[model samples]
Target: MTTALAQRPPATAAYSPPSYGLVDRVAGLRHHSPGRLQLILTTLLTLGLLTGLVAGLTAHSASAGTADLGNRAQPLMVEAETVYSALADADTTAAQAFLAGGLEPAALTQRYDDDLARAGTALTNAARLVPDDSDAARAVAALSTGIARYSALVATARANNRQVLPLGASYLAAASQLNRETLQPKAQALFRLATDEISAGYDAARSSWWLILLLVLSVALGVALFWSQIYLSRTTHRTFNVPLVAATGLFAVLILAVGVLFANQRTHLDSAAQKGSAPVTALAQLRILVLTERADEALTLAAHGSADKEEDFERASGAIYFDDPRLAYAERFTTTLKDRHEAYLTIHGQVRKLDKSGDYDGAVALAIGEQATTTFGDLTTTLDQAIDNRKAAFTDEIGDAGDGLDLLSVLGPLLAIAACVLALLGIRARLEEYR
Candidate 1:
């Protein structure tokens, strides 16, 4: 029994771990030159293909986004802003024209019509750009309905005023209320929505994630191709592999060219926002505030003894001079506006004094007189010029941003594919020697 137990193998030795022969053979492959070359070739080809495809898709997507911003998104946003500004001007013109008495001045009448025409054109353009299901479209629809009603009210007010009816003032007030309370709010909403869409588009145009992945894969592929050349040079006593060298040079140039294109696009986008869109929006708001102030001046004379008249004027003045933001491009205009505003305000104070002293007729003349007209008109004209200038700048910058993007989108994939073919040819030459 003792002999039999001693002859038995130990428990650990009785069952040996089974050899996975295929896996062992595969694992041992790294020690051979052919195996090493195969590994390098496979890695380089995989990286090249992945980098190429991802780079192509990312370029296409970014180019599409840039084009959308320039052609569709930004134009829509600017049109909405223009609609907002024109509507406010029309409301102000209608109010002041009412105060100009029975027939109203022909100049003022023409101005009111022009303001409406401008607003209508901008609204039509915005509507064409926005999708029917979007909030911007709904806002446009609301403004269309509201403007018609507001215009009808103003017409009724003018008719009653021609006959010197007391109801004329009430109709005018109703028209102003509809414009300020309803129409302007809807226009502003459309502007906000359009701005949001533009912001999203800018982000889509500069997809950093895709670019980052491309850069990483490109470096890996480049390194593998380079190392394979070194390995061949050492093993085969050859100093250079032409195809591999060419592949490396092609990839390097691709990275540099694309890097520059992306960087330029980013710069143009930033300039568009800073020097164009941002300043344009700020100046538009300022102009609207000025228009509201002018309306208050006219409406106060048309119907006095209101508690909020002077307070509203002061609030608007505060916003224009202190509360409202100013941009670099608008600095000169802002200064001119403030100086002109002070002169207008001085005239306004004199008009108020006469009205309080019971010279209502004289007060009306000074309020709508030549001096008041010139000062206000100058401010409006200058503001319009500034807005136009910024808009032009925006167009130019956006155009530059979108330039060459389409070519790059197509070129990226072709270059990567070419690089891969060269790498394969280079690797096959080494592989043929072993076979």
Candidate 2:
């Protein structure tokens, strides 16, 4: 038995008395071996490399989220603007034709048809984009119905005008109410949606800057660790620790590059929003202004043609339904509309005087030339110019926004993956030396 024990090397020191506790076990383990400086360096370098990788991943994620939201919103905003413009233009053409003496010019008729068709198509596209249950989708659907009904009313009004029946005026009044009540409010809702999304995009863009700071920290930490490892190697007279230095340098480059790329991407997105979306929004507002004026003018004319004051009162009260329920009566239409009405009242009083004097033709001619053509038409052209200016601005901005983001969308991921792979390879090279 003694010979056997000696041959078994005293049973390997009886497993070191099973350690007294966890702390004791840890103490005992440490007593057996001291960590090399190179190992400490490697540990720090590995941590920095992981931190850089995590930062890169986070930046990529944030950028992707921003890109997705902005990209989806862009085309939808375009569709909304197109639908609004088409509806407004159609109303304008119909009103112009009415002022031109019962004669619906072929061109005006065709324009109405085309615009109506375009509006329908646009609404269909919007529905597909917005989903069945969204508020935006509901607003669009309501607007579509209102447009169809208004178009029919306008047609009826034009037909009645051929017979010199005052009922045409009544139809015009109803159509004007539809424009105010259903379509405008719906349009406003869509605008709010677009604006909200745009603001969110700005938030996303701003938030991404945090990634840059993380990158900076990671790079700084990596450099510090790398230098520490070099110092240790020189002091200890070890030639090198391949994994430790390699991981530090690799992570440093990756973190720094990711930060730079993200900064560039954010700048590009900002440029896009400023150039394209902002201008378009302004133009869209101008178009709304013009359309409101046109509808108000049509209502005034129809009120004048009504048989009794009762009809006029009913139409005015009914027009209220078209305005947003949330807004007070005074705020529903433009201030210029009040001015237009004051001017109309003056002309109307003069026409009543002419009627008393048996100068009906003179009154009629004055109504068409001054009230219809000059007052409303000239003012509309001025507003149209404003609309045009805004439209041009929006077009340029949207183009820039799309181009800038799309560039980042393509380059950001590719560069990020490449950086990650390079960092991993550098780390692996050091790890391989451990074998």
Worst 10-residue stretch by lDDT in candidate 1? 321-330
Give lDDT tens digits, candidate 2, residues 160-191. 98789978867866775676566756767776
Assess each prediction's global lDDT (C-alpha) against the native: 0.81, 0.56
Judged by whole-model lDDT over C-alpha atoms, candidate 1 comes out at 0.81
**Highest lDDT scorer:** 1
lDDT of 1 by residue, 1-435 (tens): 999999988978765533466567667778998888888887888888888787787778778888887777878877887787777777777777776777778888888888788888888898888887788889988988888898899889889988989688789789988988899889889988888888887888787778888888877877777777888888886799889899888888778767888888889988888878787777777777787788777777776656347778879877875234437866767777678778878888898899889898888889888998898888878878888888898889888887776787888889988998999999899889999
- Candidate 2 has an lDDT of 0.56
Could you tell me which residue pairs clash in candidate 2? 180-322, 181-322, 243-430, 272-401, 275-397, 276-397, 276-398, 280-394
- Looking at candidate 2, the ten consecutive residues that score lowest on lDDT are 321-330
